[model samples]
Target: MNFTFEVLPEERIECLRESCNKLMAFQKSVASIRPELFDTMNFETRLLPSMEKAIHNYTVVVKNNDEIIGYVYSNISPKDTYSNEFATFFDVTSVNKPYVGCLSQFYIKEGFRKYRIGSRLFSMSLDWLKEFDEIEDIFIFVSNGNSNALEFYKRKGFNISHDILDGFITVLRN
Candidate 1:
């Protein structure tokens, strides 16, 4: 299968709406710890606000011809940004740097999951995040029950830091 990867400009982030919504639904389906929490999560609630708050953003989309098959969203954000009204993502003070990098969101359509597309997307996102010298800590948050994603990040060099939201989310750190 011939697939193309493109870095989406912030102005065109809307191009990811459908894929983003589906990713949320997929997570909800796999969530056992608090699936209802995903009811408030979607392109608008989750990804949009994340993009707005991030200091720097990187989004890459994979296409099979014209259909978007996958996407990965990463960002550099203030370490304090992780501690907010929502459950504090991690101990902000633990990171000496003012900013941190996050592999914020990732998804590959069911049919495309076995194609190594995810590996490529992960690598691209991490490479972009690594470009920032100020970023010392990199994190990936996996919703509960998404063992495959948890293991993928682990194998790629992230370690399980802790769970938040009463075990609804697993925080992985590098």
Candidate 2:
């Protein structure tokens, strides 16, 4: 099936809310396998707020006709040096170049995993980041034990740049 992607508008609060709830539900199910894979309340209490603050966000949705099967949301900023997680990553590396993009979230429904939806989301996010002119590289974190995710990123030209105890950080320099 062919999927069309687009940016979500603010007026579509219902769509966003539904998608957010679905994403959280799916993540929670996955978190059960590795309870430590997620934080207890970060998504609803923190990240969602952060995402809301960045109104110029992107939500790439994969649709099979009229239904939305999956979606990915991302927020980018050069001033995102506030979080300890970002600080920890910066300490081990250097942003010697001009541009760096961070991916806040990338999610796909389980039934649609084989459709390259994740790749499309990643590509669209990176492409959108480039519109800033200063973003030449992209960075993201994946669970340490998510070997499938690790391998997917690797196949898409991302390299393991840093490894924390719980997860590994990967980057793609442009």
For each candidate in turn, the TM-score is 0.99, 0.72
**Model 1: per-residue Cα lDDT at residue 15:** 88
Residue range 1-174, candidate 2, lDDT tens digits: 767776776455356555556655555554425444344434465356656656356667767777777777666544444245533554323664543566766667667889878888888887787676555556766644456776877887777766554443333333
Show model 1 residue runs off by greater than 4 Å: none
- 6: Cα error in model 1, Å: 0.5
User: Between which residue pairs do clashes occur in model 2?
Assistant: 99-136
lDDT of 1 by residue, 74-167 (tens): 9999998899898999998899999999999999999889999999999999999989999999999999989999999999989999999999
Q: Which model scores highest in TM-score?
A: 1
Q: Name the runs in model 2 displaced over 4 angstroms.
A: 11-14, 18-39, 52-56, 79-82, 85-87, 96-99, 168-174
Q: Return the number of clashes found in candidate 1.
A: 0
After the best TM-score superposition of candidate 1, give how far the Cα of residue 9 lies from its true spot, in angstroms: 0.6
